[model samples]
Target: MTEGSKLLSEMNERSREVFRRVVEGYLSSGEPVGSRTLTRSMSEKVSAATIRNVMQDLEYLGLLDSPHVSAGRVPTQLGLRMFVDGLMEVATVGPDDRAALDATLGSNERDVGTLLDRVGSALSGLTQGASLVLAPKREAPIRHIEFVSLAPDRALVVLVFADGHVENRVFRPPLGQTPSSMREAANFLNAVAEGKTLSDLRGHIAREIAAHRQELDGLAQDLVESGLALWQDAGESYERLIVRGRSNLIGAAEAAELARVRTLFDDLERKRDIVDFLELAEGGDGVRIFIGSENKLFSLSGSSLVVSPYMNADRKIIGAIGVIGPTRLNYGRIVPIVDYTAQLVGRLLSER
Candidate 1:
């Protein structure tokens, strides 16, 4: 038998029950659990002998540890993983939970940052663990374009997006950029690029420029080329990432647990790593759950992520929404919560 299964099959019903209850108790109280603790309590059905033998098996499986202070078994990281993965029965979210998530989606016309803040706060409250909501670095679609020459060496480049957004950037020509070349580049973009994506727009402009190298004199060509390069570089900039729930770290009982949360915050603040986390949410399509140490991204912290990616009208993936909490989390109930939140996000974003 494989390792996980071998460990599980060796576990009888009584063993499973003892382990789950003990783990749950330890999680709740942050204390080591003793067999006498079980005998005197509600789970009194099993003999102390039965509980002891089972607890020993759990220790052998590397799921539980006998700490020196309490002479009682405490859940190891691996133990928590097993309980979260297969033993714990999660309750689905109820109507009240749905209402809580719905409240975060009420404002449809507000900007993205406000929406993200609300999501983070909502998740923190729901999970009682810290939450992080990463926002898209920028949101703009092409609307219209205009080029105006203010002087022989300077020109104003204007861009309009379909979202009724307008941005104006000024660029100085290399030496003498004739107004005609500026107009040509602007006219080409406005006419040919209406429904294209932002990345698509950049590529199209580059291709057009490259396909015809001899279309303008040195000064005019230099002005047009530099302007394109500058905008593309700006667009490549990252999206803002927001992490909420630093307070959760302070409550972790063990120093080891505290270090993990610190490392997680460090990674969440990194643009590239945060982007990877976002991508994981996007790939899952619906709610995705990561158990304790199941992923190195969150391994150090013994945390879990319940995430869902919300979509736009075209069914395009826009962003992810999720909650981060300790691994002892109730996944069965939280799964429904995360799923409902993603639905609300999609509905809110799509509303006219």
Candidate 2:
């Protein structure tokens, strides 16, 4: 047997029962569990002294810890991990939740931002914790491009993608450019840049202008370069992580828990690190669990994440959906909820 399995197997029946009861109690109430409490709940007739001895043994095994000198003991991060991976019983998503998820996410909404917002809100309402959605990073190919003059020196660039998604960005036209010239530039791009990504179109337009500089007027050439440069620089704002229900973190009134929740808010503000952590789930097949300090990103907050990757029609991993809650959160209930939401997200993307 593996080392962890061997450790579990070596525990005697009474010790296992005592350890299970302690973890369960801690998870249910977020409080330290005492030996007397375990004695009362346990089916077998066990004395408080015997339970205390068992707890001491488990603590020595690095599975439990006493938060205070006199207070009852609580499960350590290791203990929680062991309980989740081996001892905990996971529950499936119920029919009502499934129907709610379907109703919320079943829309044919083509706007990616709107879809993700709805997803985050739905997950937050269901889980009663903060929800996160990592948007897809892949850019769709350009099917059409149009430029409309907004002012003497400003214009709106409308890009229509092959997937029927449209995006608009403001562009500053070069000096001495007219509306007719802007239209010409847009037409030229639409004719030649179709099916090419923004990056590819930038390079293609640069080379075309270099070779055929005399074919267009000076203002037209400058306008083309300006539009392409504007798009290339806009890449930073594209894919982003969406977060919702941060207030749920502050639901607990305990001073220590409130402090931890404040730290978690600070962690969420560091979007880049959270995105990198969520990206780890992209390589996995199904739900990925990061319990408490197991992930350095959330170690300070003492929070846990249950994330699952969603894919596109081509089965390419596109993004992730998950919930972030305290270590004492309901793991058994949330696991299947996350898993099912991920599958639903993938199916929705495929249909689109």
Candidate 3:
């Protein structure tokens, strides 16, 4: 069993009941739950004093804490983690939500960006938290390729894929590159692009260039290599990160919480950092949760992240989708939503 389970095993039934009630109350209201509150809701009608002693014991075990000396106890980060891992009962996604997700994502839309935006919007709205989506790199076969010279030194490479995706990228042409060389490059690409993805075409070109079998001149060869290299270096810039409903994070923040929300806003502004952080989910099999200081990016804000990796047709992890919200957010409810959404996205991507 996990450490959380072990800790739970050490607690007596009465202690467990009180702890569960405290965590549940805290999660629902984002406030400390007192002994009287637990006594009123507990099944066995335990006295308030007995519950208070149990809370003090739980607090000593590093599972609960009080915001003020006179106030009741709220679950600490450790307490929340323990509750989530051991005591909390996760709810299944309802039929309405499941149908909603299917209707939104199962549309005939082939555009990856539109699908991803819809996913972000849906998750954020449902969870009432900020949604983050890491879009996977596309590898559809190339349909057509063109090089349109923009300036003497710069040119635009327009690439169309078989999946109806078009990408335009700008590259600096080699010195002495002319219309003739650009045409030659386009012709070469069109010749070999049939049923081949950009990466595959790049490999074929590299092999041909190494064998010195191409008919293109030096300028055109350089242009082809530079254009391919540009896409490689761009590192999935074609709609990689989609963040939605950031304003939803600011709802119902107390004056004391404003600074933390500001800190979270600052964290969100660092898109690169968030992307890097999401990459950690790529290594895991299913849903993972990070609370409070568990994830460094949101440590200062004391936020929680519930993320799950979506996979490709080959069962390989491709990207991730998740939510960012306060530590007191509804873990039981939101967790299954994230898990189901990740599976749905994987299936949709596979079908495409």
Candidate 4:
């Protein structure tokens, strides 16, 4: 076992009980836990003096801290991490919650964006914290591509994926391009780009156009290149991180916690870091927890994230779903909930 686990193992039963009660009490009510408060709750009738001695030992071991000179003690971030990893009893998703998730997320919705929105809302409501989902970076192969002319120099590009999902982008054809050239370009793309992903099509179309440049006029060539490039750009745009229920973070905040909440809000606005953080979960199997000061992204905010990566049919990790809340969050309950939701999202995507 690691040093932390060994330290926990060496704790006497009474000491462990006192420490657990202190952490649980602090988590339940965001306040420091006093020895007298813990004495009344213990089953073995431990004295307040004895509890205070145990708390002092816990503080010396770096598991607890006193915010003020005479105030009660609170669990530090290290203490909370050790409790979550070693001591906490995770709660299973209740039958009612399981049914609610099933009804809400297990619907027949096939649109990925719409499904993510619903998932975020359901998770926020269940956990009473902010929810975030990183959308899949890989896209389905194209089944069809069409171009419709709105004017001599403008058109609409419609992409139909193999999963029956359709996306449209407004296309600005090269100057002096005509309607007939757009139709011809669309027909060529429809024939060659089918059954290929954007990455594959980019390389294949580039080669095909270079070899057959003599067979087409300038406008048609420009339109074909523009259309393919546009589709590739659109695919990149779909790689997004969706956040919901940020207001819930504010609602649960105490006066002193507002500055940290504001910092978290600023961090959310920087999508690059959030995306990078979620991507770290892609290689892991189960739920991953990042406590305050453990990850620099939320260190200043004293926040915690419980994230789990979702997978596709081939067991490839595609995306992640998670909850962001204060360090005092109910981990025993939320860990199982996030794990179950991640599994459900993976299964749904594989089925789709």
Candidate 5:
């Protein structure tokens, strides 16, 4: 055998059979796997002593984790990875599940961001697991944008996009403003800024207006600066956000351990960390399954994030879709579900 193939660790046929049953059981129950459980469940003939020895070998190889003497062994992260990569069969979604997923992909008349929020909410509700939706930062094309003043000290900005999307923002006025002044600002902005990004237009206009030593009154300058700040800040506000299933996590985890769970709840209150994870996946290629130690942000809270890229009509990865669940997730089921959801998100975007 070649060196590379030989280095690929695996068990014999009989041991493989036992390991499969053990892993599946552990995933289903979030519990350890005792030799008796394997021996009784599988038809493979093996002595308890032999199974014990094999478990020892697996532990040595970092595939099985032995928590304590009285407890049984469980699959470690590497073991789970290997099982997912090599042994996972593509489990089909059932009829109700298929209908549900199709329904989710169908009901939204919203833009990408709102659609993602709906998806996240659905996944969390369906699986009773934490769900996260990640939208593409650099790819939401501009259709149209406008600004209106709500008051002398308050201005309203409305953004419209080619994808039949709209967004709104309210902010402080530059210093002093009026309804007629707001009209001039909106007319001027809409005329020159119909097809540019909120940020790009804001920056370009700020530079041009500031450079002009020529004309307007102090009030017009104030209107310009306030509009610029509102544009910049509102652009940031539209960024991808994370929505977690606190209840789902609670259901999956030991809710009895309230202190630790509360801290976990508090950590996700910012939603920034999960957004960072989405940004990382958007910056890369396709599917990403971040194990426990791979990311410290997740490691601290014992969570795992699985993300997959979704494309637009131009075949650009305009966003990503995935689930956020506890570390002891059923990768066998959730992995395929996540992959399928990503495809659905892409298809929806393409239609738009």
Candidate 6:
């Protein structure tokens, strides 16, 4: 048996029952649960004193904690982790929930950034917690490429991908460039952009130019090179990390809890750290849970994160989606919701 199972087996049946009741009660109410409360709900008519002794034993095992000297006990981080990993009965997404997700995410949205933003928002609304969406890097092959002159010096580069997603980037065109030259540049890119990502296209263009194979005027060649360089220089940080529904983190929090929530907000402000943390989820399978203190980002706030990586058609993990909430969140319900949403998102991305 696993260590957790063996440890759990050490407890008598009544102690295990009492431990489950206390955890359930604490998760439901976000408050300490006393033996008196468990005594009333338990099928076995155990005395409050007897239940209290069992609680003390559980506390000694580092699974429970009493905030005040005389107050009831709440599950510690280890206890919460144990409950979630082993005892929690994850609920499947019901028809209503699945339908709601489909309606929210299955729109005709062709823009990846907007779709992912909506995803984060939808998850936050459903979970009543802040949502994190780590979008995949732009890797789809180009389907169409065009250059539209926004001004004499500025031009808009429109790229439509094989997945039906679109991206627009602005770049400064070469001086004295005309509409005809812009058209030539677009033609050159579209001819070779057939099945290459933007980064790949840039390298291909450079090689073609260096080899002196393409017949193009100097101005048009310069425009082509300049536009691709500009886009590349912009890099992948644009909307790569998205966090939504932060206000939910602070909802009705007490003074001390509110302080912790503020700290979490401060942590969220460091998008780089959040991105780094989300990238770790890419290495895991299915839904991954990080409870209080497990992740330093949420350690100060004592928050928890539940995340899962989404995949592409090739079953390759691309990005991650998850929710952040208090340690007392309803894991039994939220775990399945996050898992289903991640799977749905993967299928959607694969189809596109």
Scored by lDDT, the top model is 3
Q: Write the per-residue lDDT of candidate 6 for residues 210-279, one digit (tens) a residue.
A: 7764588788899987876754636453777789999888884667899899888877776657456656
Cα lDDT, all candidates? 0.71, 0.82, 0.83, 0.83, 0.68, 0.83
Off by over 4 Å in 6: 1-3, 142-234
Q: In lDDT terms, how accurate is model 1?
A: 0.71
Predicted candidate 2 versus true structure: per-residue lDDT over 190-268, tens digit per residue = 8778998775776788888888788777777788888776655363455467889898878843677788888888777
Better of 2 and 3 by TM-score: 3
Q: Model 3, 71: alpha-carbon shift in Å?
A: 3.6
Q: Output the lDDT of residue 118, model 5.
A: 70
Best by TM-score: 3
Which is the better candidate, 5 or 6, if ranked by TM-score? 6
lDDT of 3 by residue, 115-184 (tens): 9999999999889999989887778888888999999988888888898878888878887889998998
Error of 5 at 145 (Å): 7.9
Assess every candidate by TM-score: 0.75, 0.76, 0.79, 0.77, 0.72, 0.75
Give every collision pair in model 5.
none
Q: How close is candidate 3 to the true structure, as a TM-score?
A: 0.79
Q: Name the better of 2 and 6 by lDDT.
A: 6
Give per-residue lDDT, candidate 2, residue 239.
43
lDDT of 4 by residue, 1-352 (tens): 7656777999999988988888999889988999888877898988889888999999999999999887499998878988987889999998876776777776777778888888888888888889888877556799998878778767788889897878778867788877777777877787788998776787899888898889777788898988766744353545367888899899889899999999988888766575566665764679988898876667888889888998889998778888999988899988888888888988988887
**For all the candidates, what are their Cα RMSDs to the real structure?**
4.9, 5.4, 4.0, 5.0, 5.4, 5.9
**Using alpha carbons, what is the TM-score of model 4?**
0.77
Please state the error at residue 159 of candidate 1 in Å.
4.6
Cand. 2 Cα-lDDT? 0.82
- Candidate with the larger lDDT of 5 and 6: 6
Q: What's the residue-level lDDT of 78 in candidate 1? A: 71
